[model samples]
Target: MQFVKERQDAPAGFFEVEAAGLRWLAVPGGVPAVQPLDVSPTRIVLPRLTLARPTPEAAEQFGRRLAITHAAGAEYFGQPPAGWTDDGYIGNARLPHPRQPIESWAAFYAKYRLEPYVREAYDAGVFDDSARQLFDRVCGRLADDAPEPPSRLHGDLWSGNVLWTVDGAHLIDPAAHGGHRETDLAMLSLFGLPHLDRVLAAYDEVLPLADGWEGRVGLHQLHPLLVHVVLFGGSYVGRAVGVAARYG
Candidate 1:
């Protein structure tokens, strides 16, 4: 069986980049990615996946495997996936995937992740001047923070992207790139996941998270919230502002 996704009006390179992202995120002995069969500008064909209720055991295994996937490690922040050499998309928004490495995660994130969507939301009138200033303050704090090496990230790891099956979780619809691993984890938390506590615990056991990582969850969450504010304005504005206020 095959799953075919078609979007005739998709932006240029949409399905092509999605296929590239899935291929890039495929790591041996790691959580499985839904295999792409064929791709074109407007459509992608993938192996069919069956949905199942998530189990705690599967969640734990997914965590450990996800740690291995991140361990595959990218050369630098904002690096595009191996096959594709251009920016990608997250949901409906363009995601920055730069060729040049930015060694500083903070700088790369501030520039590529936060600033673009923030400015877009501000221009859309979803964000007021105060909200913009709050994100600015957060960026300043990031500048001073110690940086970690870039990880091969799933980039858009929201729970909906994880398809549970009899075998376990298979990742689909990635915005994969070289980025801070915490961003992926934070995204998982953005929308609730099944057995989330077990997932985080198992991941920590495989690769211990940084100290104060709990405190920094909101910081990592800012990007997605900002994206949401741009993509779907409404209560998302307040949600993004509240999270930014914590770090700002």
Candidate 2:
């Protein structure tokens, strides 16, 4: 494999690995193997693979494959390694290392994941008292149910994180962990990207999303938006507030 591009923004000591084990439903068997060799704290080497902007059909297939990957499931929530970050960002809400069993998704997300960030931001003055109260209400509603199944997630998935290669699509730089699959999909849509419609269509064809899945997108995105707000500052605060308002 040869070095192609370098990423400056990734957390320290991060690198992509070969796409294996997890079977992507859209691609039938799996994605073509590629090596993600670490070059430095913020760089990795990827073998050159020709890629073009995806067409609608291709995007849909990508979505379907993602759903299948999620369908593969996890033994328990929070199984993947915690995300690495500089400056103690603590992106995943300081959840218990090596995730333990939890009765419901709501409880897990509430205690181990969402609440911590809310509290941290509140304590730091990132959010006003009213915003904090609204967040609390949203968490309360989340406690009513667990996700249908625990999924092996690419915790920090986004449009740029997806690499469309000649052989197949690739997911890189994952904060890979077990959590709600929607979190991954939610991130994809967070920053508008091409081929999204196709991806969503394919995903729904395979997994058939629940009736109110659209409503939950805001909730799923809350974590990342909050992270961005905390890391980058007030620019993301409005977006975070918008998501919170939807849930409130």
Candidate 3:
């Protein structure tokens, strides 16, 4: 495949490369700023790396570092030239139409982040009336006073997204945005991968979670669960309904 690289002066040695119809770039130093870019036609291929279960201490330390990085807030890298979707769903609602400003995290999540997915699921019959009602309740609660300030987010984070390289652990395949830091941590917890205690301990060391974080886990998870409900049907419907129940 033909690959073109555009150079940038960032510390990580960033570059924008195009192959096929998709556009992706590499951040030279180990850490991946966003999920490895996977345009459409050309796919991103990386070397094989070993991933072992991190020790409690190592996991905690790594988790702390991730928290610090997430706290770095968002970047306005100009407007996207086009729109795309994941699997079959749109990447995110188009920005700057009626409500795309980054005024507050809660508003962003409510409109652009969670609501779109919720509406999709509702339209697809993935969510029953009760489930939809509960979801609205949780969103309202979160909107009241979100736990943390808007921080840069790795939209879709899971164990698979964390690459353990020779240099250190790196995050890849990010659906990057500016939202809550806990959203990432909540994702780590939701999937049951990545050592839980260690990850939280590490995050606390760097940026301690606010009180009542435990209660908000359901709120943060609703978005992902809704996505799953849309993508995987019955399997996620129960889980999504359960989470919605918490706020209702």
If the candidates were sorted by their TM-score against the true structure, best first, what order would they fall in? 1, 2, 3
Summing lDDT over every window of 10 consecutive residues in candidate 3, give the lowest-scoring window: 12-21
Q: Candidate 2's residue-wise lDDT over 161-180, tens digit each? A: 67776444776545555678
Listed per candidate, the RMSD to the true structure in angstroms reads: 1.0, 4.6, 7.4
Q: How well does model 3 score by local distance difference test?
A: 0.57
Kindly report which residue stretches of model 3 are placed more than 4 angstroms away from their true locations once superposed.
1-40, 75-99, 144-147, 165-167
Alpha-carbon TM-score of each model against the true structure = 0.97, 0.78, 0.73
Give Cα distance to truth, residue 92, candidate 2, Å. 11
- Count clashing residue pairs per candidate: 0, 6, 6
Which candidate tops TM-score? 1
- Model 2, which residues run further than 4 Å from truth? 4-34, 38-45, 81-98, 144-146
Error of 3 at 179 (Å): 0.8
TM-score comparison, 1 vs 3, better candidate: 1
State the lDDT of candidate 3 residue by residue for 1-248, as single tens digits. 33232323221212112111122222232134433333323244433455555666667656767776656554321112123211111222222112234556666667665677777788987777777777787668656354455565555677676766444576654555456777878888888755678778767877788887888887788778777777777878998888778776
